[model samples]
Target chain A: MTAERSRLNLRDLLSETAVALTARPARTVLTALGTILGVGALVTTLGLAKTAGNQIVSRFNELEATEVVVSAQSTGFGDNTRSLNVIPWDAQSRLERLNGVTAAGTVSAVDVGDDLARSVPVVDPQGQTEFQIPVMAASPGLFGAVRASLFTGRYFDQGHEDRADPVAVLGPAAAQRLNVTRVDNLPVIFVGDEAFAVVGILADTARRPDLLGAIIIPNQAARDRFELGGVESVEIDVAVGAAELIGAQAPTALAPNNPDQLRVAVPPSPRRVRSDVEGDVNALFLALGGVSLLVGAIGIANVTLVSVLERTGEIGLRRALGATRRHIALQFLTESVALGALAGVLGTSLGVLAVVAVSATREWSPVLDSWLPFAAPVLGAVIGLVAGTYPAWKASSTEPIAALRGVA
Target chain B: MRSLRRSRGAPTPDDLDDGPLEAWAVPTAPAGGLSFEGEAVPVVVLHQAGRTFAGPPPVEALKPTDLVIERGEYVAIVGPSGSGKSTLLHLLGLLDTPTAGSYHLDGIDTVTLSEPERAGVRAARIGFVFQAFHLLAHRSIVENVMLADLYRPGGRDRRRERAVEALVSVGLEHRLDATPATLSGGERQRVAVARALVSEPSLLLADEPTGNLDTATGDQIMALFDDLHGQGLTLAVITHDRSVAARAGRVVGLRDGEVIEDRLVGSGMR
Candidate 1:
């Protein structure tokens, strides 16, 4: 015959795909469900990982990134004796003068032997009302360095430190133990034979929470009464991104002559911490997404293969109508790809919704990569293509005569 | 004998020319006058064509046989079950290749053609009407007819137009938008006929076209075939029903794996 060659165009392929898929709406939706769940999980897990990682890193940056601790190195003795690294009494002022240092302070524990603290002047020989509370000597700037908030009264100032006053600030635990609730009356507690006036009761400290249970006295008062010697540790609070700088400079600022005798502890870099956390989170979530996607792909493949088997007569008819094997393959492939792309769109929407819903419930800002929504459909299409490969081939290879006879 | 004598005359390109492409037209030189002899080639020519299925002991399905069918002729192949009727039909439709001999359709050697080339030839020159109707149930009558042209090489501009015309010719114009599910058995067969004719193929091969229809519907379909034959189109119908076979101008009867009888019936007019 003087006829043009038989061929199938892209438009016809797409139209045929549409007709085949829409012919059974319920089957189409059921077949696509696997991909939807898979892609949805992928997006949700990835989004949640990013959002939670951001929260953790921001909190870590706030506290760990800004606090630096400088402690005197012990001389490898059995006791808590330091290596003569004298942090001078003016150490707080010296360290605070450095750049990025918000506040600085010195703290030392006073050794009290067989002495107990009591709310009343009588020394209870029965020891029922007497308590053996550890005593702490701290500079006035310690309150600021630790970010402590007061309960009612004010903090002991430099005047009290210089004049060697007996006024004391009780931690919450110490106050409760001593039966002192209000600081407005300036309650006094007797330590051994000394009556120290309670100046303030601390509600909370940001850095060292242990200070909440100890009875804190001025550095000079502790030195004068309890014979306190070398300062134990210096706490310095610096600005964000300045912990390493302040940590390196604080030891020298405290003891310029024997700076080597002081040990500085700086928090790990925020960038490293953030990456480590994100990497762990991404790996775990990506694996979950990958597994779900694999299951989705298998669902597509299994359903497509079953469809091909069920439609052998149709395939045979097409072949008899002058469709080449390639035409048959393309038709089925196009159908599956369309199915996958549709599922991808649905999965992405569901995933984004899940992320937003969870974030809203938890009161967190949702985080998602902008490209995710755009790429998900394409990825789903690719999965469909791969999954449809064998089925399409099976359809294309069906023998026209055998299939028409219903033998295949 | 007249057709055989007339086929010897060399037909010129002018003799091959006809009216503008329509739903039905008797092709003068369907294969573009591929025969260098310049003579009118028969629509089908078989030289010892046969099919055999491989088995522990090979089974000869259709023994080597020779057959010829000329243009504008209506021929019927009838036989009981397992009579090699299906083998001959498959061979003629180009659905199966012959292992014993050669087949030439519309002056072109079919055995040497590649699979894709055979498919192209089938698309352009042969239209098949299955007894089952084989209409796509999900599609409208018009769309089912239009699909006949989907594999044909051409711009899609006039495809729907040709399909509508074919449907109209088959008296299905009013039911263009109706699906096969909504059609009777006879109406569906007519739709199948329209789809087959939409391509304007050189040969129409029907496999028991009335097998799935009632007597009245079968008669109606046969009457449609009579009209198509009156228009000088080539037709080949395979069936086991003697009544259906009696309508064709020529009948070839098969028994087992060989043709047992070939005869003319009715007016035997081409």
Candidate 2:
């Protein structure tokens, strides 16, 4: 017997593969759809992670890093006589005069003493959803420092503070509680029988969220009415990368004679927060992408198995034509890999288009890794290769004589 | 046409010394065991060849049967249903293995050959035409014929040319680009013949070549086989029809897995 070395003809195999796929066009398309969606989702998630992470890092890198909070430290007195350093009323102006400080404000908590705020004269005991809101006093720059949005007229200014006028700004939650919707109606709320005119309502604040449910008054007005004991803390907004400098110099700026009495708190580094956010986002999206890929692989395997079964006659014919089992296996494997590659190309285009469209609509710069589009196709081919192995084996292992029995 | 190359490590049989390309052109007029040179090497020889189906209880499809088919001999293996004609045809075509005894094709002992070695022998020296005319429906007639050249040892640069020549030989050159679905039954059978001839095999095995055709079309196909046989092509046709068997130079008859009769076509009646 002639023991000839066998080799598969690549051109003929490809032609045969092409004919096989085109013979059942609908099945081919349906099978490819699974891979398309899988690859598209994977590419989309990777692109969005980069885009969203960049925005998050850049957003927090500036203001969040530059922010510093200085608070009063209580000095322990002998025999429980607590002596706390009081922040001066002009501390906002003093800290603002520093080189790197952009905006500063003196924040003091007013002792409301279980007092209820109401738009009407009397507080009914049986009223539903009673409002026992906290009260606080701060300079006008508090609006800019905390990045608060105004729902109405304005914040209390320096003129109001100098005059010690009973002007107040209600938080959005507090305004809702007291039924004060419009400041133009000359709204007034009674704080335990003492009246204060409403000037503005704060919608939201990023830095100071507690202020969203509180009543805010001018420092001078709080001192007059509640005998606001002492300046509580100072909130300072500095220039980018200037938080360290400002924090070091803040205590001296607020209380020059006894700088050691004050304590300064700096915000966390932007790098740490950026890495943490990226890690969480990547893990979540990767899991989703992985699930999609697994589903796609299963779809490929199922369709390939069915194709093998359907082409038993062809496999027999090829074997009769002197094709080895390895040749048959290679043919099927190449077809699957080709299908996967096609899906990869199409899916990547779709994903890129989606990212561009969404980012354009949202006014965000689309950020994607440069190599993703190129590598995604290879990854898809590998998935297809792995998925096709069993089906190819089944196709190759078909008994030649048994297969020919069906033909004749 | 590109000159064919020999396989690297394969043992070359005596007849193949002239190469498969030259084998196609060599005349085969002097019948029986002897070629024109008076060499008595049979193309196919079986020594008690038989096939048993592996079953819950093993069934012997072909009982130890002996047969010999010489070069240039037009032979027909005829039998009724379950007579083991198909089993014998499959063994002769190298499509199956004999469960008992030995088989030699073109001077090569095939009983102990490896799968790939058997396939190599099949590709280089054997051709098959099935009853169903199993043409790939998606391919044009020429492409179907070109399938034979795909397994050739060297790169196939003249496949289109060779396929065209084979189709012309079978009188289907006019339908080169036509798909099998568009062809008539006889024309499809002709395309299958062209595919079988494209490899220039030493022995041509046809299993019920006209089984699916009308009597008139089957007559036409038999005429085509006659023309091929006239050109010195060795043909073995397996059929149940007596008319198909009448055309062969010799007939081997089977009944109940045994060769009941073996005779020249007219000598049995005479």
lDDT of 2 by residue, A159-185 (tens): 999999998998899999988888998
lDDT of 1 by residue, A1-408 (tens): 433456898999998998999999999989989999989888888788778777767676577778888888887677754546467888889998999999888888878777899886457676578889989999999999999999979899999999999999989999889988887777889889788999899999998888998899999999899988868888888998899888888888888898888889998787776677778877877888898899999999999999998888788778888899999999999999999999999999999999999999999989888898999989899999999999999999988887787722
How far in Å is the alpha carbon of A101 misplaced in model 2?
22
TM-scores of chain A across candidates? 0.62, 0.53
Q: What is the lDDT of residue B156 in candidate 1?
A: 63
Q: Please give each candidate's TM-score.
A: 0.68, 0.66
Once superposed on the true structure, which residue ranges of model 1 sit more than 4 Å away at CA?
A: A1-5, A60-268, A271-294, B1-37
DockQ of each: 0.28, 0.28
- Cα shift from native, residue B169, model 2 (Å): 0.8
Error of 1 at B28 (Å): 6.1
lDDT of 2 at A258: 87
